[model samples]
Target: MRILGIDPGLNTTGYGVLEINDRKLRLVEAGIIRSKPSGTLSERIQEIYDGVTEAIDSLKPEVLALEKLYAHYDRPTTAILMGHARGVICLAAAEHGIEVEDYAATQVKKTLTGNGRAPKTQMQLAIQHELNLANLPEPADVADALAIAFCHYCVWRGQRVANQSADP
Candidate 1:
């Protein structure tokens, strides 16, 4: 199964593709969709929408995983942009007939690092180790994207096991 994990942002939306089989993972691709800050809000959103749509087309993933937004009092503008990014992401997935799952930040970190409040570096290191990568994936955005993918893999595997046991 192939999964596409997205870290949404108006400035740089990050994405990572992972192929999984028998609990093993292989990184297919990882990158960010950058939008120029000089543009109007509408133009930036359009750029993000177009970039993410192109990624979905190229990857053709079986599942889509999105990092859920966690609010902070100091960053209302960040929260608003995050919402915009998420809107475009949902639209792209829906248009492609892909089921999207939104995982809370804690859920993803716990699944990856065994701790809900694990630091970003810990999550990044753990993901690198779990995926058997020699070096860390750069630009925290990419790391977060990969962690989202890993979280889905772990959760999906658990669900599959339960279903198999429930069946005759």
Candidate 2:
């Protein structure tokens, strides 16, 4: 299966593509969709939509594993802004007929590092080790996106095995 993981943000939306075969993962491509701060809010949102749509068109992922947004009571504005970006990301997936899997940030972190509270640097290092890349994927968002993809792959692969044993 080919999976695309998204870490959506209004200014900088991150994406990572992965191919999973026989429960093993291979990195395809990873990068980000950036919106200009100078643009209006709607413009930023449109940027996210267009960029994500283009990525989905090119990468053609079977599933989009997106990070589910969690709102901190104290940071309602931040949460709302992130929701807008998340909407565009999911819309792109829907337009492409891609299945969507939502995972919590903590879930991805725990799946990658055995600690739900793992720090950003820890996530980056873990992803670097997992992909065996010569350099760590940077700016943190890219690594988070990859970790989300890896978590989705792990769950999907396990479910496949369980379903097989349950059949006949």
Candidate 3:
């Protein structure tokens, strides 16, 4: 199974693709989609949509995992804008016939690091070790994307195990 994880933002969206085979996970690709910093909102949205659509086409992932929206009282606007980015991403996935699964950011952190409130550096290290990468995943966003993907893998594996035990 191939999973694509996304950490969406207006300026820079991060994405990671992971392929799982017989319980082994391999990184297919990881990178960021950058919209022009000075572009209009509509232009930027279009750019993000296009970038994600391209990724979906090229990566051909079976599922897309996303971080659920979190809104802080002090920065409600940030969440609102992020909602725009997420909207286009979901649209792209739907267009490509890919299932989308979303997990809370805290849940992703806890699943990977044993702490729901793990710091960025800690999360990066955890992902690095899990993937057996030589260095920490860089720029935080990429690490976040991988964490979201890894979280889904953990949940999916657990469900599969539970089902197997229940069968006989």
Candidate 1, clashing residue pairs? none
* Candidate 3 lDDT, 1-168, residue by residue in tens: 999999999999999999999889999999999999899989999999999999999999999999987777899998899999999999999999999999998999999989999999999999999999988888799999999999999999999999999996
User: For model 2, what is the C-alpha lDDT against the true structure?
Assistant: 0.90
The C-alpha TM-scores of every prediction are 0.94, 0.95, 0.98
- Reference-based TM-score, model 2: 0.95
Clash counts for the predictions, in order? 0, 0, 0
Q: In model 2, what lDDT does residue 117 have?
A: 93
Best by lDDT: 3
What is the lDDT of every predicted structure here?
A: 0.89, 0.90, 0.94
Flag the better candidate by TM-score, 1 or 2. 2
Ordered list by lDDT, greatest first:
3, 2, 1
| Model 3 lDDT-worst window of ten | 68-77
The model with the greater lDDT, 1 or 3, is 3
